[model samples]
Target: MKRRPRRSVPATLTAVVLLAACAFVAVAAIQPIVGETPWVSYRSVADALHGARWTDLVPAIAGGVAALLGLVLLLTAILPGKLTVLPLLGELDSGASRRSYRSTLRAAVSTVDGVSAAKVKLKRRKVSVKVTTGRTSTGGLADAVRGALERRLDQIVPAVRPAVKVKVHAVRSAS
Candidate 1:
């Protein structure tokens, strides 16, 4: 089973804003009945809205903004989010987060001889490994790092194996 991401942040903010607006309207409507001053001057607001012409610049701008906001909310609700988990191979259903996957690959590359540090970047179709080593000559180091990375990938067995590309950076000696 594939796992899909969620638009929680946008949905949450939108819900909060709507709730606040509704609560404000409810309070404003109830204030006069209870003989209390409303937070907003409802009469002025009503007069301004009623008096404004449809073709007025302020009304037109407000209408455009509302339409744009509605469009954004609609699109967010309808669009499918990007996949957060990468599916793994095998009968049992399983997946790994991108962060963990990249770290695992980085660990594999770092374990190779002469590798001081490693950075792994995972993309849809490629895994880029950057290795930093103190060794002056980096001949054949890239290939070794790539091999270790591929070995780790084989062990994990992700459904879609991204191609591994290795780059070795030689750190200069302090002397």
Candidate 2:
């Protein structure tokens, strides 16, 4: 079976094309009146191009295109009802805070049986942990890591119930 090629239209390009098409249609529809007008009749398209009068239309055309693009982007942004930049801002502003929290959580979870090291990632409402275990069976190590992390979070942030996720990496034989 031949697979169909996926088609994608970039929002910016779509906005520009749509706006330019509308402008062209509008100009075409009014062409007869424009030709009849004294001002337009006096200045032909050749004269406009030669004298660089088309330069004057540049700003208006650019403005219309920008407005259309802005409208498309604004609608796309608002329709989703999610903050696009806030989480990025938080990551930038609170790097140290989050890193410290992660380290502390990692230390606590690493104390659990069979866990050799723990890596913690704390997002807005949840904590994810990757546990390096000293035991071949990762199931018990994952459970222990999750339990420790949840207990630590409950002690620190009582108002928030952090969802714990545990992944095991590099299981070793317990000596």
Candidate 3:
């Protein structure tokens, strides 16, 4: 089974929070109509809004939050999904996941001469590989890894083309 990509964070959180708020609004609206109910904390909304200074401040803060939430939701809805995978050439149906991309990059770096281990992190515009190189010549590992990655990327053209950066940390010889 194929898993769907997740929606934006603010959109998901805002939807859940707004649904909870609706329940509160429903109870608040019906409180005044429910005669002789102990839950009737206020005589009317006017009294609730007119009294304490905190009441006005609370609503103002809530309004600000609500406005920001609304703006984010609109933007997320209008914007296209951020694609992290590269598609197979001439085959739109076949694509690679970002996780697999990072894994392959790590494998590529680890295979390079003098590289004892490697860790790769994929960002929007850059692929960062941190490697522990053994007590051997390490001048060309970075270039080798970068070349391999570029070749891999050329093979599978992703939506975003990120530059590669390799950081080689020398492993200390244990006495």
How well does each candidate superpose onto the true structure, as a TM-score? Answer: 0.83, 0.44, 0.69
Top candidate on lDDT is 1
Candidate 2 lDDT over residue span 1-175, tens digit each:
1122222345656778899999875775587676643423434765765766435877679779899978876676555331122222222332124455677788888788777777777665677888776666675667777778878776555233558888888666545
Ranking of candidates on lDDT, top first: 1, 3, 2
Candidate 2 clashes between residue pairs 3 or more apart in a chain or in different chains: none
Model 3 stretches with alpha carbons more than 4 Å out: 1-5, 27-37, 50-59, 91-93, 154-161, 173-175
Could you give me the TM-score of model 3 versus the true structure? 0.69
Best by TM-score: 1
For candidate 1, write residues 1-175 as lDDT tens digits: 4677788888899989999999989999899999998888978998998999988999899999999999998898898765678899999999998888888888888789999998888877799988999998889999999889889999999998899888889998545
- Candidate 3 C-alpha lDDT tens digits along 1-175: 1234567576668778889889877787686677545354656666877775854778789889889978878877776564555544454466677788778777766666777888888776788888887755567777887887788777667655788887877786545
Number of clashing residue pairs, candidate 1: 0
